[model samples]
Structures are given as C-alpha cells and as structure tokens.
Target: MKKKSAVLLVLSVLVIGILSYIGAFGLNVGDYRVKSFSQMLSKGLDLQGGVSVVEEIQGKADNTAIEKTIDLINLRINKLGVSETAVSKEGNNKIRIDVPGKFDKDEVINLIGKTGKLTFKDPNGGIILTGDDVKDASASISQETQKPIINLELKPAGTKKFAAATQKFLGQKITIYMDDQKITDPTVDVAITNGQAIIEGSASLEEAKNRADIIKSGALPVKLKVVQSQIVGASLGADALPKSIFAAEIAIGLIFIFMLLVYRIPGLMANIALVLFIVLVLFIFVTIKATLTLSGIAGLILTIGMAVDANVLIFERFKEELKLGKPVRSAFEAGFHRAMSSIVDSNVTTIITGCVLYALGIGQVKGFALTLVIGVITSMFTAIIVSKHLISWAINIGLINKASHFGVNLRGDNNA
Candidate 1:
C-alpha cells in the first residue's frame, strides 16, 4: 500500500508537470494545432485591442427598448463576422460595445448601429409587409436566371398580405426598401400565393449575402447615436504580459525558497502543490474560455500568497503537535486535522469576498474577482488534499521519520 501511494505521488507530479507545460506553451504538429493556449483562452479588448463605441439613445428609449436594441445590434455584429464582442448598458440611456481584435472601423460602425428596416411597399407608398413578417432570409442562386438572389420566407400573415398585393397588381412593381434605401423593385409576372419571395439586384454573391444577413438581423427597437468611438491599441497589454510573467516567476521563486527554508520537507511538498494549483487554475480558465486581463494576473499573484498562508498554517500546527512529543506519523495526522478549521475559514471568507466583487464589479474588476474566486477554490484543494496526500505518502514510505525533517527540534524525543 505504501509503495502504491509513493508511485501514485510520483506519477501525479509528472502528469501535472507535463499538462502545465502544454497549457502554457501549447503543442502543434506540422500544419495542425494539437493544443494552443492562445486559441483556448479569450482575450479582452484591453489585451488584443479593438474598437470601443458608446452610443446614446436618440429618443425616448426605456430600459426594455434599450436592451432589445442591444440584442439586435449583437445579432448584426455577429452577422458581420465579429466575435468576442462585449455589449452592455453604460447607463440609463447609453450602451457600450467593445469588439476585440482589428476590423474595418467604418464598416463595423455602419453595420453595428444600423436600424435595418425591411419593408415591402406598393407603388403608392403603402406598406404591405415589414421585417417582422420575415421568418428567414438567405442568399441563393436563382435556378432560372443563375444570378444571386435573396430567398425569403414570410410569416403566415405576411404570406397572405403579399399574395393579396401581388394578385391586385400582377403587372406592377412591388419595391423592397432597407433603412429607407431602395433595394429592389420587381414586377410581379403572376399572382404569387406561396409564402416565399425573391429579391434580385446584388452585383455579386457576397453582396447578396450581406444584404440577406442585414435583413435577417432585423431592425432596432430604438434609434441609437454613436457618441464615442475609438480604436484601442494592444501595446500596453503587449508590454505588460512579459513583465507580469517575469514578476510572477520571481515571486514564485522566492516563495519556493522561503517554504523550503522555513518548513523543510513539508514545505517542499507544499511548493509542488502550489505549482499544481497554478496550473489547474489556468487550465480551468482555458476550459471555461475566460478572458484573461491584467487585473486577473494581479488576482493570481494574490492567491499565490493565500496558498502559502494555508501551508504555513498547517506546518505550524504540525510543529505544535511534534512539540507535544507525538510520533512523526501521528503529528502529520493531528496537524492536518487541527489546521483544517482555520484553513476552511480563511478560504471561505476570501471566496465570499470574491463572489461579491464579481457580482458588483465591471470589466477589469470582474476579471480580478473571477481569478480570485477560482484561485481560492483551487488553493483549498491543493493545500488540503494535495499536500496532505503527499506528506502521508512520504511518511508511509519511511522517507520522513524524524521531526527535524519537518523543521521541529528533536528535544531528545525523536520517534520513528
């Protein structure tokens, strides 16, 4: 049993080390990517750099209308092929948008906030159908003309209305307009009874696709004006990444030395657990696709300190048990059992604080809180589970039999 535990410990350490390396640097084969930390992790606007726009409601827009407008804009932005975009309400009357990575600023600006009003009108300017009546729209090639056309599916009511209008004016043109701009005015050759229609005027397939997407995205519930827009350069984050990593390295090196010097063998085990804790946290971040920001790094550093504090509490309890003339094996068990309360208390309080910060904070503060919460939870696991198992295996394998190895004085009471 002792040998099995010892082997398990070794294997655990090796596995953690390899996974940590992969998570940090990634691995690829030829043209295919096996694993990539960069691809797994999402970056915020501050990290990758992009455009930030704050728009104010132009008219009497309430909260519900503003929220609906934001949703419609999000659909439009996605249709424009933008990902990792953040849309949130800035205040009562303003909405803020952050798009990560570079894009055509002018094109994005026009597409994101456009009130896409799709309407089918008679030559007399009476509306026959609107965007709300369209269930779906897609760009396709016409079977007869072999030209790009937008195929549209209408709601039941729209189908009836369109069928009646086409019957009334079989030879006249029914014009389609998007945002008050004329898209197509097609003459109805026959009375159309089906729920489907086609608009053809696009110069190319891509243009037809764009027009279809714009029509499908729907119109905003309220008008919005771009009050502020600017491109964010990633230079600050690019410079900060290396420096933050260097600082973390130095901090981790110092903690390792301090733990080894102060608590000896048990501290060495704690260092290993700490390394695993950091790796596991980052792996979780990647899996959850959390965007890592500068403040998140700071939160990680703070959690490292908290992890060390937990180890210190356990080691202190272990020394206290040894001073009571207990055997090394008994001391290890008593130390962990007695220290569990304090460890749980401190970590629970810290996690609660992280939850509060995450709930109330925005942007960078939310990032900091997220890392803090994840760190605290993982720290508890590493300090209590990983460190305890490591120490127990060391003692069970007869590797640590003396109190002095645990940084405790012999006092003529050494016990195997």
Candidate 2:
C-alpha cells in the first residue's frame, strides 16, 4: 500500500506539472495544436479595446419589435467582420452594442443603427419594389462572368412587380438604391416571371457581401437614435492586461510561500491543490468561452484567497487532532469531517451571493459574478477532494506521520 501510494503521488504531481506547462505555453503536435489559456479565453470590450454604442428607440415599441431590432442590428454588425460582437437590448427602449477590437466609432454607429431601406426604382425615379419584398440575398461569384455578384431572391409579389417593370422598360436602366443612395443600375435585357436576379459589377466579394448583408437585414422595426458612443484604445487594454497578470502571479506566489511556511507538509499538499484549482478554473473559462475583464480577474484573485482559507481551516483541525494524540490516518479523517460544516456554510453563502450578482448585474459586473461563481465551486472541489486525497496518499506512504512535520508540537506524542 505504501509503495502504491508513493507511486500514485509521484504520477499525480507529474500530470499536474505537464498540465500547468501546457496551460501556460500550449502544445503543438503534428497538425493539431492546443491553444494556451490566454489565447482560448476571450477578452471583453474593456480588455480588448473596442467601440460601445447605446441607441434609444425613438417611439414606443413592443417586445417583439425590440427583439427584431436587436436581430437586425446583429446582422448589420456581422457584416463588419468583427468577432465577438454583442448586441443586446438594454432597457425597454434602448439597445447596447459592444464590438471588440479596434473600429471607428462613427462607422459602427452608422452601419448598426441605420434603417437600411432598400428600394428598386425605374429611370423615372418611381419605386418598383422595396426591401420588404425581398426574401433572401447572398454574395457569390458569377459562374459566367467570374466576378463577385449579389444573388437576389424576391417574394411572389416582388417577382410579379419586377417582371412587369422589366417588360415595360425593356432595354432601359433600372436603378437600385439603399436609403436613397444609388447602388446599381442595370439595363433590362430579357425579363420573365422568375424571382431570381443577379446584381453584377461589384468591385470585390467583400463589397458584395456587405451590400447583401445590409439589404438582407431589411429595415429596423423602429427608428433608433444614438444616445452614447465611446471608443476604447488598444494601448489601454494592452497595458492593463500585463499588470493584472503580474499582480496575480505575485499574489499566487506569496500564497504558495505562506502555505508552505505555516502548515509544513499539509501546507505543501494544499498548495498543490491550489495549483490544480487555478488550472481547473481557467479550463472552465476557456471551455465556456467566458469573456475575461479586469473585474473578472479580481473575482478570481478573491476566490484564490477563499480556497486557501478552506485549507487553513482543515489544517488547523488536523493539528488539533494530532495534538490529541490521534493516529495520522484517524486525524486526517477527523480533520476534514470537523471542518466540513464550516467550509460548506461559507462556500454556499458565497455561491448564493455570486448567483444574485449575476442575475442583477450587467456588463463587467456580470463578468465578475460569473467568474466568482465558477471559482468558488471549483475551489470547493480542490480544497475538499483534491487536497484530501493528496494528504491521504502522503499519510498512507508513511511520509507525513510525525506531528512535527505538520508544524505541531505535542508534549508526549512525537509521531502521529
């Protein structure tokens, strides 16, 4: 049993060390690559730098209208080719947009908040069809011309109207406009009843896609007026990230040293568990694609302290058991059992608080609450299960039998 425990302890340590290295530096094997936590974890607007805009609906609107407006705004933002953009309804009449990474504030405001009314007009400037009549629009390469073009599919009513317009104005130019700005004017060659039409002459595929996305998004259900806009610089986020990381490293380093000095062997075991705890929290963040903000980092640091607090409680009880002259094995069991209630009470209350904050908070507060909840739960697992098993294995191997090893001095009992 001792030999097996020793072997298992060594293997666990090796596995944890490898995982820690991979988490920090990542690994590349052949064609497959494992991204580091810094790469996998997403940075929020405050962390990555971007534009934030809030727009208010000019008139009264229902929930459905507001939802549709948000959806249309999302479609418009997607055309910007920005990743991790967030468009959400704030209050009853306001919508908030967050686009991560650098972008022009006025350009984003104009694109996302535009009504995007698309119309087809005759040479006499008469409206033939509106964007509401169009069902779908996609940008693709024309098979014959080998150039980028927009394929437009119109509704049944639009098809009939377009067929009549094309027949009446055969060989004449028909113009397409978006918000009164002319997009294209093509001469009608042969027009039939088909609902499909191709708008050719785009400079590039990207330009065609942007035009299609705008037309496909149609018009917003209600008019929106920009209320506020702000741009965050990349330099600010770049500076803040390194400083936050350095602070965390220093804090964790001090924690590791303090635990080792105060609790001896058990403190060493707790520190190992703490390492696993941090890795698990980071893995969860990456897996869930949670956005990391400065406030989120703060929550993570706070939970690290709480994780150590649990270990401190358990180790204190363990020392008391050893001083009572209990055997090492029995004391290990008694220590965890005695500390279980206090640990549960404190962690459960914290979990509840995190839940409440997540429910009521917005933006950075939500990010902080989410990290807090995940950290607290993971801390519980590492402190109770991981730390317990490490200490148990150490005792089983006869590696930690003396009370002195646990920083305890008993009058009559030298070994526990």
**CA-lDDT, candidates in order:** 0.84, 0.88
| Model 2 Cα lDDT, one tens digit per residue, 121-217 | 9999999999988999999998998999989899999999999998999989888887766767878878846989888778999889877876776
Per-residue lDDT tens digits for candidate 1, residues 8-35, read: 8788879878877877788776897657
Residue 256 Cα positional deviation in candidate 1, in Å, after optimal superposition:
1.8
Q: Each model's TM-score, in the order given?
A: 0.77, 0.78
Model 2, position 318: C-alpha lDDT score: 87
**In model 1, how large is the Cα lDDT of residue 381?**
92
Per-residue lDDT, model 1, residue 155, is: 90
Model 2, which residues run further than 4 Å from truth? 116-217, 412-416
- Which candidate has the highest lDDT of all? 2
